[model samples]
Target: MKTRTKSEMNKIRDIAEDYYIRLGKKGRDIADMLGVTEQTIIAWKKGRDGERTWDERKRDMELTPLKIRELILQEAHKTLSGQKSELDADRLAKLMAAYDRLSKKTNPRTVMDVFMMFDNWMTDEEPDLVVKFTEYHRRFLFYIIERES
Candidate 1:
């Protein structure tokens, strides 16, 4: 296995912790999947053996998911704008998967509703058409966000 930097390790830990919360995965299961010891997973979770204080670790954990999304979008924009020959497809895909997994609760309706509130945003005359559009968006998002393994 390749060695991971502290930042990378923390990101994985955050994802695993979130998985544990959302899917009822045990720390041992997460550790086994990641090829880490249960003790290490516990340490990371408890902040008992980590270099940073609990608050700092918590803050980083909280921001990691958002950061992953930002990085993926930024890199995609860079690629699309011809600023780069090619983006890291593997990294970008992993980042997107991670973001989608962690952001499963993100409501597509909230966004569509906000846009609909604006005048002339969605000019569909039929109410059923609007409902169908909203449902399509919601299903589209769900299709992209892979369930936790």
Candidate 2:
């Protein structure tokens, strides 16, 4: 069998990492998909040498919506800071559009916000059920928070 170059091995490892962490794929599945052995994938995940494990990388690289939006804005600023060109302008436009889309009001509100709005409406429209609703709402909110955690 031909030996792979360092760059080729690094490329394969990066793809395997994406499949395993970002896509939440199993080691065996990733190995099969990438034409490697399950042991190889496992070794990569566990950090064969002194390098950090895939799980550690995943934990460190968690991306939230706000973080993504910030990245887009940063990219836009970088694009603007470069020399002016048509391609740079186009890239900037796309980045700005992505930032605007991410910042839109249509983004999901927290469960508490939605529930509080509903509670207020119910208090105004049907004040008699407020006490019972509050009890159930508190339980439901805790359930959701616990599940999310």
User: How well does model 1 score by local distance difference test?
Assistant: 0.66
For model 1, residues 36-147, the per-residue Cα lDDT tens digits are: 7888777766655546644464566556556767778989888777787355767777767878876876544345446456323455455556666767766665664543
- lDDT of candidate 2 at residue 80, scale 0 to 100: 64
TM-score for all models, in order of appearance: 0.33, 0.39
RMSD of 1: 16.1
lDDT by residue for model 2 (67-95), tens: 87766667666666774443466766786
Clashing pairs in 1: none
- Give the backbone clash total of model 1: 0
**lDDT of every model, 2 decimals:** 0.66, 0.76
Candidate 1 Cα errors over 4 Å, as ranges: 47-149
Model 1 residue 124 distance off true place after TM-score fit, in angstroms: 26
lDDT minimum window of 10 residues, candidate 1:
115-124
Which 10 residues in a row give candidate 2 its minimum summed lDDT?
Answer: 102-111
